[model samples]
Target: MVDNIFKTAMRWALIFAAACLLLWVIMPEWKSVCAGLLLGVFASFLNALMLRRRVEIVGQAAGGNRRMGMGLGSRIAMVLLVAMVAYKNPETFNLPATLAASMVMPFFTLVSAFLHHKRH
Candidate 1:
């Protein structure tokens, strides 16, 4: 599920990049890119949480602690990403980016848990 969420995020990034470059001809507001990033982050996190359903198989497994492998690195990366956004436009950063980034890490962790269960 971690892999799935990362893959899903990558796919979303590609689609978003293309839209940012191409769609600007139609909708010139670069703010749309920011909006899209907000939505993309939301969607990726939602996808991650949805994928966590795979962890339900833990009931059948001979598990011990059964913990998600999502560690500090990914979280640190997300934090840095958010910080970058904040620094790039401190006064101007909107609520959506802040909210979306806040939600992504737990979603990634949940999906990581699902992947752990699936591995067993």
Candidate 2:
């Protein structure tokens, strides 16, 4: 199940990256937009990795301990880090696009989960 989620997330990220590259090639003026999208894709990938690892940790627990690996604060920090990067360089990062891109992970994850649930 987790593997499926990871694969779906990666597939979406790659698709988005490819689209971003194409957009960059077609409209060089929107380079900042592309960069922001790429950054979002990267953040999503990191989130997926952390999620996978957390699932593995729970699965491998000796008993019924339902502990999580990376806490909510750490995840929020990651989001803030991305925001900070864009905040530090609004001209280059495109704060609006960066914020939009940051949402890709959770959006796709929900989609994947819904699809998985429907299939089951």
lDDT of each: 0.53, 0.78
Model 2 C-alpha lDDT per residue in residues 19-108, reported as the tens digit of each score: 998998999899888888777777767866776676677777857776655555666777788888988977777777877887788788
Predict model 2's lDDT versus the native. 0.78
lDDT of 1 by residue, 1-120 (tens): 556656655465555546644654665555545554554464445444444443544543447656454444455465556656655664444445554544554544555557667777
The collision pairs in model 1 are none
The reply for model 1, stretches above 4 Å from the true place, is 1-9, 21-25, 30-70, 87-95, 98-120
For each candidate, give its TM-score against the true structure. 0.34, 0.82
Clashes of 2: 0
Can you give the lDDT of residue 72 in candidate 1?
45
